[model samples]
Target chain A: MVATGTWITQPVAFTSYQVTLGRIALVGLVALGLTAVILMGELDLSVASTLAVAGVVMASIDNLALGIIAALVVGLLIGAANAFLVVVVGINSFIATLGMLFLLRGLAFVISDEEPVRLSNIDAGISFGKPLIGEFTPRILLFIFTFIVMHLFLTRVRVGREFYAVGGNRQAARDAGIPVRRRIFTGFMISGLVAAGSGVINALERTAADPTAGSTVLLSSFAAAIVGGILLNGGRGSVFGTLLGATSLGILQVALTLSVVQVDVQNIIIGSVLFIAVISDPNSIRAVSGSVRSFLRGGSVLSKPSVDPKEATNNG
Target chain B: MTSEASGEATTTSEAAARTADLGDRGGADPDIKRRKLHVLEQMANRGIFFFTAALVLIAALFIDGFASLENITDVFHRAAPIGIVAVGMTFVVISANYLDLSVVAQVATAAVVLIGVSNNSNIPMAIGLALLIALAYGIVNGVAVGVFKANAVIVTLSTTFIGLGLLRWASGGSIYFGPSDGPIRSFGTTEIGPFPLSMIVLVVIAIGLHFLLNRTTFGFLLKSYGSNRNATRLAGVNTALVVVGAFLISALGSTIGGFVLAAFSNTAVSAMSSGFDFEALAAIIVGGTSVFGGKGSVLRTLLGVVFVSVLTNIMVLSGLGFGYQQMAIGALIAAAVSVDALARRAAGK
Candidate 1:
């Protein structure tokens, strides 16, 4: 909160807290979905783009009720498509999502004709863009709801455990009789749905759904997952970690921007952190370090029997 | 290294295939894999060139000014960054690790640091600080990748954001310091002859990288390290150092690229190299470098970058507009990546 006067600072602290709350509500829910996918050993760069498409679709609809349903349906369909390709069809998650990203972005550009879609709405004497009750807005509520739901799904549900197994080790998970395919599908779908929900919130806040909404968020999501101490290769990240990641990222950007640091430098810092974290991962380092020692000590070909089919001749 | 191992294993499999005494060996799994690989290898060797050439031809027919000397120079020059980036990635890929996505940000980080420091401080001190910061970044990534052994993609992706954000924050998220900055200007306006200085820089880096990859024990070890990382380790090589060194080299490439981009713009921006990763990566993959690592070439990457640059130039000149441009380029990337993936399968055979 950065307050020298503590809670006695009154209005200033209150505004800061409200702003933070507003940011979390807007970004946290989708980040939660992204956390799920990352936990399953994948990155979803297209989540932002997914949010854009779903929000645009919802905003474009005539009836609010039908629009909400349509958005969810579209999100599910897109998620399913991604899951089918990535989890089931075995396409690399990043590439598959990359394609989806371009496709969705292009579609957004086409539909919006490069214009932002403004959804007109207001309730209880407050505009959609403004905070309700000191930033305890509907978006904030949705964020909390999504977080609790995902936490439950991941921790309390059988399906969630299966998701972890698939990420931890596909072969072993299969060996243990896990329905790997379904878990993966669900993972991707969850990613899509939440991203879409994030998009809806984004649209509501701006009152104008941006076609490029998720175009830039790819970096943010990755930053969140990594800084939150979530491992990229799956089976090692947490939703809470993602929350922290998203929060820290938001704070860093805001703090830097507010301080006279230029915005671009902020980007560099985020990217650099991600890279460093990746390189310093323990398992990867051990594997690499162990290999170097082996290569030096015995000059024997290091072979993992489960994987290496070429070890015999490589030594020679 | 892994290629050698895989190559040897395949030969054995080939022998087994021959010994089986059935032409329908193609009917079975290994045989099918081999058959597929045979096709892929053929594509890797020559098909890549044809693909690039054909893309050039298609651009010429469809795009105006596409075949001009000006266009050719522009295309090649534009590709220089990716060419440089690919040279670094080729090492990492060959070493059986991941390519550095943070490279995209590294370019900007280096440029901004180099230009920013030079603009603000004494030249030597600025240069020293720039290099110091970049090396710190490299070590951070290297330690994580080499010491901690994280997946290259996530690590680099995270750093990409950090680096880009840092650059923007430092530079005010805008085109910075324009050509007035002398040291930064060299990265852009300098030239050895009719060629832009950036092109010459590309040539220098390419030659150096090629030498590093093709002629050195380090290169062989890198290849070995990637192909069968375990085998290389068991062979008692310091796989950690090698992998870390791979990141250092990749960062070096990004530094060079940053230098050149600084040269090109005479100013640095946060998004200067924003989309360079996919471009460099596309070139590497399109050049027939394996996404799974341990099989690709710089020459092919050069060609791949040239091909992409040429295609983009042609598309721009042709005036196909934005949507068509994106669609066509997207299609091309997918096609190239698909081909490269297919080639890996072929090489596997």
Candidate 2:
């Protein structure tokens, strides 16, 4: 889609292509973290709010290193808080994180006084995003680096593989001696940290931290994850798929922008795209198609589920 | 807060029964820890009432004007729309579908359809058409989640974007204002013996839904399904129908809320009902509706709605900004759910 767009938007230089990649890198960072959290059979709806708070906290600081450190710490704290709410308190993950989302968003507004916090040293902040090679700036490099590391971590590391086990069947995993709570904690914390990283990079790129900084992209991150095949039911999908999803979404976004598509129209398209992705889930496709088959045969539109609920429960 | 009136009947009857049960087991264990745990469990079970009482007393004492009948009625009037929405949410949550995130969009869409079409044509037909559209939205969600077995959260989230986007496109992202001195606007503010019409509508809906939830066969099947879907299915129930019914009820609530909200302001905008989704959920959860499903009551949810309204009203009276108010509500949700979880754990449930 991106290549097709580049072809139409004539004089698409290498730098322009890199700009698209740069955009992908930013969204990819957040999607990557989201994918990990979803993989653990839990969710962190607070990521965008965490990003906003982190960005504001970072921009409010004067020292360069300290500002970045402060932002990362803020992310970790929010992530830890989320972990505590879900793991220790035993509140449902989505609801707990939903509360966190509102709380952090309110915190951001309160601290920033409902205004954007400007970076004290614009020159220092701008340098952080400066291109290191052929328009591949530090931001892009960090995204790539993190992607490679996360890919290896999930695929190769023993503990990383355990995350899937934890998400797939938490009780069974616990019975199998996997540290379920720890894995869930790690998943949320990583998501928080990565979300903060995205926030910091965004702050540097924009040279200010708006209280509403990541609200717009929050849905997009979820879209990217869904498109990438990260199951919401958890314990499935890979980081690489999220990267592909993010990149494609990035290209589509640029294409839409170049074509002058209105924001509402773009939202419709994205919503439709998300719908298609969810509908295409293999399990649901089988169920829906089975119902269709039954309907065609003059049976009820929804045929009785083959497994008797009583028998299923008894077996369990 | 109608809870003051309703809470008395519910808390006393419920508490008396609970304490009677405790008396039956009286002095047997004599374990300090066990006795203390029992008291905490009782508190948790009846916590919403106690919480509301404490908040009301504190607010009445500390916040000037909070004790006034006018201010109290204003809070009830303010809670009516969201209370309606929360009543519908009660079904969805009890069924363990988690949430209907599309309520915000559903409300806006209904409002836009109601006022937009009414201005162009007539009010009665506009009401019918708006309800039809809302039902259609409900059906799509119902089929997707019930028949296809799709994740409820993701399906509703996508529908929210789609519904709102389509609404914005259709309405050109503009606010639809009803005629000045329109009958609908007057209906919104019409008072019957000091009770606003909207509040009266809410009470009627609540009473009807309360009976439906407790007395109807569908309601029984819904609770059974929510408590244990597979078990209900084994009992030869069509779980899909029950799930679809739940979503339809939710959409109906949103439609009525839309009518009340847009009528109150004489304007319909897509963003008018923003944050309603969470607010309704917050009320349900605080009302002691288990997030796990199969355990809730419509009357209890009403109390939850009033509790939230009074809290917000007190915050406004104290001159707190919107940010702080949001934070307080957010914290309340987390704390409420956590307390419920802890109490359940203690009771060995």
Candidate 3:
């Protein structure tokens, strides 16, 4: 906020902060779900599609409560379908979800007839965008509440800890009787439910549902989870870290907007940031620091260029 | 204590050997029941071949004008660009490098660059510059994945975004259309004796890649490395070179495909080749290439490309809507991958 204020005097008003915060909360809901799936060593590329489908479903229905229920149901079904393909059919998660991503996006397009649906008349009796306390909106509060609950679920629950074990080593987890398949299935379901919630929130906030709503969310959510220190390989990261990561991204977007960076350039910046974060993972960081320290001490960093043959054998 | 320790070591070694054998046979056994399953798995692995034959027969019998030589030629011509790109994807996946999501972005970038640069410069110069740009992206992807040991998926995806963004920014979000009455346009639009030039180019590239993958030392090293990177490294192969080579091949394929597409369309746009990466990958997977790497043939990818093209042609002839067509493609990919996985599992691999 301070940096943004310093950068642009004309736009540095209280409303800017409120808008930015609201945007963060909206995107953070998707990131929260993504963090769990990543922790369980799976990728859900269909989240954006799911969000679109749910949002469309909500916007199309006449009754607000019924619309919300229908959207959640759609989300659960999609999640189950993804889980069935990946877990039951033995398809790789990446391939299965990639397929689902296209399939659901197509479904959304079909259902909405490629038009944005307006929900201005639904009268849900709740204003998600309205400020609940000072500058904080109901959406932001809901996002914060979700973060705390997910953090507890992951850190304090036994079943949640199994997500880590399964992701870290599936065979070992299976051998340890951890019910690896069930954990994976459940993780995907949770992702679906959260994605649905995100869709509903978006519809409520904007009073509209667009078929393309979730398209940009996928990249941004992945960016947040990765920047939050969540390993793409899974079995690591925390909900709190993800929150912080999402907040940082929100701040970065504000700063960029203040600086009047082009939208396309912002994409390039985000991509570069994602690349940097992945390469600067803990293992790489350690290796780089060690090499630097050794170089400073007059030691050869490239002395043993060859990795041990034994290590190679294990990988194959 | 020593006896117990020796016993534990023997058990662990036995387990390791069992797992290794499982991987080798892809979960198959010589028992009668297992042999039956093996046969089924073989048939499933070649499912695209059978499906394509069936679809062609059905189309020839039922659909109007489907059996015409001209329509057949058109399908092959259209399949050429996708086949070209799939050839490189075949190499990448077989080398265990997995998917390159940036191929579509590379294609779009190449198309735009070719048209934009050719507006002022000669055709050959534009082609060279476009290829050079594609090669640069490939090199960066190679370095990130091979040298830095970054995840292939994420690295390629990031590059995809970067490429798309940079291209859009450079073009100022405007479309580019090159001169229509040039040698490049003729190369794209011309046909010789009922065969499109693009199809001939695809066939030539396919043959060359087939030879390179099946009859060379480099091909052997690539497959060996993909199957077991550690083992190949232990054997003193330059694994990094192989990685770089795979990505370069893929990029080159994308460049060629982009050039042909741009020439055929007579225009270039930032979003021209969007979502094409999935199609190329689907063709590779459908062709019976194991996603785990160390196995695949460019020839098979060609067949897969033909199969997808024919399927889309049929759909269009049937007047299926775009939405339904997308759904079918998605379902086909999921089904193909599932069958592959099931076959592998049934083989005990």
Local distance difference test values of all predictions, in order: 0.65, 0.80, 0.77
Model 3 residue A220 distance off true place after TM-score fit, in angstroms: 1.0
Candidate 3 per-residue C-alpha lDDT over A1-316 given as tens digits, one digit per residue, 9 for 90 to 100: 2234234533543347876687678778899988788998788889998999999999899888899999999988888889998899888788789888878887887888888899956455256667789878878888988898888889899998888888788899999999888888888888998999899888887888888888778777887888888877787888877887777777667667767989889889878877777777776566456545645777433223322321221122
Residue B115 in model 1: lDDT? 67
Flag regions of model 1 displaced more than 4 Å.
A1-16, A56-74, A88-91, A98-107, A120-135, A223-231, A236-316, B1-46, B113-133, B172-197, B320-335, B342-349
Model 1: number of clashes?
78
lDDT of 1 by residue, A108-181 (tens): 66666667776755331146556556647777777878888888888899998677788889889999999877
Candidate chain B TM-scores, in order: 0.81, 0.88, 0.87
TM-score of each: 0.78, 0.89, 0.87
> Which candidate number would show the highest DockQ if scored against the true structure?
2
Against the native complex, each candidate's DockQ, computed on alpha carbons, is 0.30, 0.37, 0.33
- Candidate scoring better on TM-score of 1 and 2: 2
Name the top TM-score candidate.
2
Model 3 TM-score relative to the real fold = 0.87
Overall local distance difference test of candidate 1 = 0.65
Residue A308 lDDT in candidate 1: 24
